[model samples]
Target: MKKHMKLFSFLLALTVTASSAGCSLSGKKNSSTSSSVLSEDDEGNEGSADGAKADEKKTDGDIRPQDDFYGYVNYATLKDAEIPYGQYGTSVFMDESDESPSEKIVKEIGKSDKKYAPGTNEQLIHDIYAQAISYKDDGTAEKEIMANCDRILNAGNISELMSVYGDLTLNYGSPSIFQFEVMHDYKDSSRYAMYLYPMQSFLGTSLESIHDEISKCEAPNNIARDMFRIQGDDYDTADEKGRQMVYIGMDIANNTDFEGANDMGHLLALEKTSFEEFDSIFSNLDVSLIDVFCADAKSRADGLYVIDRGQCEKINELFTDENLDKWKAYIYSTYISSMGYFIPDSSEILSDYFPKSKEAEDDQAASVVLNYLSKQVSEIYTERYYTPELDKGIHDMFDEIIGSYRELIANADWLSADTRKALRKKLDGIKLITAPEPHKVNAKDAKLVGSSLYESDKALTRKVMDDKLELLSSPMDRMKAMMLSTDVNAQYLPCNTINVTVAIMQPPMFDPKGDHAANLGGLGTVMGHEIGHAFDSNCINFSPEGKYDPSWLGEEDKKILDERADVLTDYYSKYTIMEVFHVDGKLTNGENYADLSGVECVTNILDDKEELKKLFESYAKTWCSLSVDSSGIERLKTDEHSPEKIRVNAVLASNKKFNEVYDIKEGDGMYVAPEERVSRW
Candidate 1:
């Protein structure tokens, strides 16, 4: 049986009302935190339960609320929760307790019999769903896929194959040897810029994250061989080609800083050069890389923001006649592996050909087809599942959190007058965007027309690329800028706005009929968690104007802020998973800081002890998770956020008010001394 709160007066206490906060939690300081987790989801970005998708989920042993708030409140839920297949973990926010939101959306759309008009959203939505579920293994699908691959990679020389890299990238969703993106400039975050990085290899890039070193180097060869076989190459030829692609891919992976990509300093450490100068990085070749950087982006190229100069130059060494077969094999392997789905029985072929390679690939997702119909699916979701009242309630909660944040910053003792004013300014400017963004979903002329899913997807890919390129010349349009509706996440965009994604507005995260405390603990705290990020060690530097500045904090203020955050870093650093690896507090401090402030911001607005109890339970429920022994161990070694239990316990430990409500004493596992507490915001 589930345990009850300490006192019988708990019911009476729940009746007491409390004020609300106008703040929220947030993402990584420089990038985005996974949106699905209570704070950071990791398994293919599922609300991260961390590592091994448990064959058998494990909840914590019996623990008193005063001793272990996270365990005490979440243990019951975790005991019964099941981790879905292919997902690393599950939580109250996005669980397997009911039908998957994505599957539900797909099924609802697929069930429609009425034919939608071509170019219309309804028609596009239906077609996307139908095509995704159409697992055509017929010879025609494979032929079309092979024909496309051969067309793109059928060049005689290295330069020829390299020339249409843009075409391959823009028209087809093939993973390239190099990744190109139109994004906010490193120095000038205000305007869009074209960024390029040497393609990190399929080996060690996904399925497994490469840390300090790369292991199982030959794994790529096996994968490439399997890919070639499934794509119709003979074993002897496949063996030879697999070896060749691994050779080329290894050269790229060696020089690429995959680990550094996670660091803010490394991310902002961009190398800019003109088109010609950038092209020169590919020495000894007549090829103009700028020509292959995609066409629509050519005119809008502010400058090439090369992320890995060494890797670019290093890969250039491979662009030679001597390595023509190597280049061809590498190109073929990547294209086939990524675009192989066009072939009917692609999944089955891969399973028989190379089952392990299929594990982490995006094409295996059940609602993978829905990605093509994002705008349409979102529109449908809003029409059927959302309400104006829900929208208003979310907006109202955000408003309350914002009010709470204003007071938190206004009263922060360590912050100087200047910093306080600036923080408040950012808080004041923070906007809340709910589901079905304020802007329209689709373009008037945008239409997908193709006999096959592959052909139709080609059109969609080009449209998406064109849309991204158009942003290069345009200022950040916050209205048009939103996360996918199907993603169960809430993000505080670096632009100082909070996104209460439609997917997160469901149960365990938020409910329209939930009592004030439940809402406060669920969605209210999420908003506050995002808003509270402004006070994190790194986010404190985000300008009200929406740019990241390393030097935003004045020297004196910076020192004070670091001193304050150091407490959090030290407190969290003490935590370990399996007692083998410790949490990287320095790497995770920004998120930890946000988690603490997220709670502090929400708790400050509510005063009733009974209501506070409910709010606290709701908050912990969001992070409820079951896992195997190896679960948090891998995450602690790799991820930037604290483990889920740490995210809950550490923050709750620092929550004096919560401690008081539960009558937690110093001996309690959940208690921290007053001086040791670190609620900086």
Candidate 2:
């Protein structure tokens, strides 16, 4: 699955109402005890009357709020801020959650003298981490990679070439002409479906983007030439080959109908067809490559795949010997790039190609293991930190936030009776998945234990693939947790489910004993934001059954939604980031819409003036972050959500409640005039 599977909005919050007195609680265990827990007593050190004052003084430095709210709230820290080594930014919640738990887990597992139980999740993580730290850069991996490249380059015919292509893609994570995968059917939302789309380059950049860069001038080609030089090519020859390969990428991008700003969101909307129909259009070329990725479903895949007929036809016409040769080079380069760490002289060869981070390869490998074996990590993380009390507190907080959303829908004047009823049903239909389900390891698989790391990792990937292929003929597991409980994030699945990962449930993001005001500001807002996605412009029309059916919305209500959404687009588009790039308001509209609804919902829950003040301050500090200039620009270009600064200030400015709580006067940075402010509620 693509890393973009997580659909998140900007989220932050504070504690509950004052009426819930003495509701002190501790969040998940972390080393930073200073602010991890809160006491409900009046004289408690944190989240007390004095605690709120301390936060105001700590954050609201000398800068005038009217001139710059982000600077005002964040300047004192930003002035002396140091991005953590090997990281772009840090937060109290993020920093505490990141290192302490994972590092501790690794340390504990590493100390074990005996081998972990065979075929258990513990065995998998232990082997992967142990192998990573002890990895020796021998010439063997490079030789294997070169041997595969040679096979592709020396193929005798289209059938032979395509077979080699299939092996690389299915086992080695390389892509040939196109890619195939099994995922939840968008049209049905309750069953698995097969999708075939144009192949994406292994390089971080997409084909269209890479091609555009090469077309600009010789700079991109010169860079590619350097990469090839590292692979043993002389300068001039590498330069020529680099330019030719880029042109090949351009041709593929053009032929695939993904020439400009293409993403899965766009491809999902394109015309879909059965595998038989798709292959008929490409009969001139061998199309059996599809079966290689589909595994056991080879025969059953007859009419299972949904594809873009136009793109397939164009790709079929473009598959000639000359183009195939260029493809070989392209694929070889990408495959080697992916395996750089495993190759000899990998550091020097890849130093210029990949970012320079202070982290060691072993640590990166450990993270990879954690990600791939998230179910295991989730189990360990929960056992050590998650408690029944924290679980109940979080669920209660979620209910409170959802209550606010329900009130908003109940009172929405813009929604007609029919549209409002449909919207409410859709909202009520949303399911909640908060923790990772137990992973049932197969003790019977020999490769699960007493195998080399490389072999074990390969087996794991194949296992995951086989499971997905099996889903092709089975029902979708809608309640399955898609993320590790240890990840510090929440998401709204389009399948009418909200996933609150266990990691994000920890403090300072969501404090149990912390001021309900602060918890409301941080976690409450997050819950509201995630739930708000169901009512966002794109998702508002989805049926209660989770199907994307715009007919659920009345024509008049749809018009109102679009108009309000445009307000958000115009408002956010004007905010500049890094002095050069502006937020892609249109791209970020859905998230921004959620942000508005979230903050508004949280604000509606507040009644006490002092508590409200604390919530506003807590909300602002949650978004307090400083990033490298280059990273900021990259975020503006690629991130669907607005920059952190814009997420804080733009969101605050949109709500009248923020102004009332903070006494944000006319011209204040936090004040958006009534006419300019866009309130989705």
Let me know the TM-score candidate 1 reaches against the reference structure.
Answer: 0.83
Q: Give each model's whole-structure lDDT.
A: 0.64, 0.63
Candidate 1, poorest ten consecutive residues by summed lDDT: 9-18
Model 1 C-alpha lDDT per residue in residues 1-681, reported as the tens digit of each score: 000111001000000000111111111111212112121111243112223224212333433565456655655554455545655555454433445555566566565898765566667766666666554555766676677667655777777777755567667777776677776664555667787754655643441333234454467777777767766778888887877666666666666766565666676666677887887788756777666647745677646777778877878887888888777776666677777556535556555543433443333333555667666666666666668878877887888888888888889877799988877888899878777553343444335746667677788887887787787778866544466565566767667777777767776567777788998898787788788776677667677777877577678988888888887788777655433456788989888888888899899899998899889988877666544334555566567777766677678877878878876554344556677677767
Candidate 2 achieves a global lDDT of 0.63
Stretch of 10 with least lDDT, candidate 2: 12-21
TM-scores for all predictions: 0.83, 0.81
Candidate 2 accuracy as TM-score: 0.81
Which regions of candidate 1 are displaced past 4 Å?
Answer: 1-61, 80-87, 93-98, 131-144, 148-154, 203-215, 230-234, 345-368, 436-447, 550-553
- lDDT by residue (1-681, candidate 2, tens digit) is 111112123221111111111211211211321111111222332322222333343432334433345555655654554445675544433333235566557656754676777777677677777776665546666677778868866876656677777677667655355666676666556766777756555244565555446554344355566657776888888878667766655655565454222343554465556666665776766656466545567554445544555556656665667676555556666666665555535546575555434456545656667656766767788777678888889888877877777888889976797877777787777787888777676777536433445455556666666777776777778887766776677878678888887777766678687889998888787888888888886677567776767776788889988998997888778766533456788888888988888889998898898897777767767776655555566666667777766676677766776667666555333445677677878
lDDT for predicted candidate 1 compared with the true structure:
0.64
Q: Where does candidate 2 stray beyond 4 Å? A: 1-61, 83-100, 135-146, 173-177, 197-205, 215-243, 253-268, 280-284, 298-317, 337-368, 578-582, 628-634
